[model samples]
Target: MANPGGGTVCNGKLHNHKKQSNGLQSRNCTKNGIVKEAQQNGKTHFYDKLIVESFEEAPLHVMVFTYMGYGIGTLFGYLRDFLRNWGIEKCNAAVERKEQRDFVPLYQDFENFYTRNLYMRIRDNWNRPICSAPGPLFDVMERVSDDYNWTFRFTGRVIKDVINMGSYNFLGLAAKYDESMRTIKDVLEVYGTGVSSTRHEMGTLDKHKELEDLVAKFLNVEAAMVFGMGFATNSMNIPALVGKGCLILSDELNHTSLVLGARLSGATIRIFKHNNTQSLEKLLRDAVIYGQPRTRRAWKKILILVEGVYSMEGSIVHLPQIIALKKKYKAYLYMDEAHSIGAVGPTGRGVTEFFGLDPHEVDVLMGTFTKSFGAAGGYIAGRKVREGPLVSV
Candidate 1:
């Protein structure tokens, strides 16, 4: 028998563990592993069956200290800059030539100040060079920075067996697999690294076709299109889907790639609160009633952009509710499952499968192979579109 939240019921009563600092609560049977539960909308969701976790904010003290630190840093940074400009100290970044000084700055003052003063101080913690594949355990090189993380040099020492806590190797596919490595080598011998042309100009290969077919089959969709780069899958294709006179309702915390794509699409973009159905509904209602601004003409199309699992927040999308809302407002839905694909769901088919929702309900299903598959590229899947009269129904 199973508990109401879908955990296995033990003969003994479940014992509650102390609450975690990150706001996770667990109840476990004596024999089984810890099972975390989150309560929302009067429903208990167990993480044992679903990988999604409730969004938790940092503790008040943590936020307070973080802001204080930044404020102090900014204050000192401005003071130093002021001193340099007033000749009290040397201005190391000052340009020496008139032509160079007159040339338009590559970055705005705020951006340049941020990189030089703020980011440079804490850059040591980011972009560490790894010596091994990003598996469960890997090696990272040791380095030292003499100028407060502005530059670093190797110390000829390695931190081996370091736990890789950050990489998106969700299924451990980054580790060497015998058959997969052999197949990859075989394909490399034939494909020769990369095609020197775009798909339309001769880049298309038999493997591309095979991969698209497999993606479509796996997604249970009518057809699929493959792209070489995952970021391009969103940044490039969004423009093809909608343009000026169209309206895009996007989550406020969506990935930067999606934001870029929406801007490039020339669509009127309105951001709704992240994972908030009420906010989304309000936006949709306003869009319908107002129509296009000034002209008051109906929009050519309306697209709702959301992610299956938001990468940074680790909060799963409320798909069922969003689908219902999409239908209510007659809006097309585009789901980016970049982080959720192969990491969630009963069979790892992604959020659609996780929620037992029909794939056809979503107009566009976009995902990347880089995360769980430990591979490169991305795909877009949806109902098959015929060239002419016979579009898939």
Candidate 2:
């Protein structure tokens, strides 16, 4: 449904304006939401009159100013690009050597322009250097930029007692003093870093099998496979599950890793509105009615990709509704619990536990230990028949 001010009226709630990852602000509502606090002059402020159960639209003027700010930044970027091209301003972009003039440029000029004139001005807020454990409170290393944020150097100063809100340390297990820290030290001494090979070869350790068993037991699934990294877990596995004749109904706001995986799968990818069961069901219905594109035949398989918790929006998935729809449509459900596992639910088992649904209802459950366990790696759990193929990926 449409909103009064050119936004989507999501679930009857008018969400506060939030800066998207691309630096553009969006006004989409968050599910199972929380009121966001606004800071003013280094002081935190709250809207005491607003009801917590209902979200209010950001002030019209605030939205206006937000766009205006971006517009101004874009205009300046264009002007800077013009100046640099005209040789009025010094060019900081990478120069092509005379011998390699025929070679394609490594980075696009427009990308460098946006980076220099737009992102660089606000880059300090991201990729900050921290000198302490990413617990509730940590230490940040202060640095200074002299060349208009083009390059930065250490100021030899540390900002102490900083509250951590950026990291995915949802369980506070990343603390240096946690009991797991001692266990990690002991394991590190014995393991000596990594296995230095792929799991398909000599890299498979008894501890790896033990961890996979623990993960399967944790999710109450038949079996599980662990991967070295969270991003690769999704990006590399989806292609193994489905291809050419398959259709993937993915949530619009799914992580980049999921997006990459779907693209790599050689499947027909269709996007459904984020966290909306109605939108998802509509897509599933259309897929069934229309069948595969061009061929006018039934798809080999249909995979539905969703996240347990949308990391950027802090929105929880409607797991029960989605499960019902997937079953009705006879589609496969692949739920990524990267940010939800060991962080939400009665026992922190994830959305399935939170909604009191059987884990098997979700065909493939993917999650990362990086967030909730404060550990590295990710896992995919399901029936042994379903997960068996992913080993080849």
* TM-score to true structure, per model: 0.82, 0.82
Give the count of colliding residue pairs in each prediction: 0, 0
lDDT of each: 0.79, 0.79
lDDT of 2 by residue, 1-393 (tens): 322222222342333333344443443322244333343333222211122223467999999999999999999889988898799999776778899988998877666666778888888888789998898898999999887877899989999999877888888888767567888899989997899999989999988999999999988998999999999999999999899998999999999999999999999999999877678877888899999988789888899999998888778887655665676678899999999999888789998777656687888999998998988999999888753333321
Expressed as tens digits, the lDDT of each residue in 121-181 for candidate 1 is 8876777899988998999999998767756899999999988888978898878768988
Model 2: pairs clashing at backbone N, Cα or C within 3 Å? none
Best by TM-score: 2
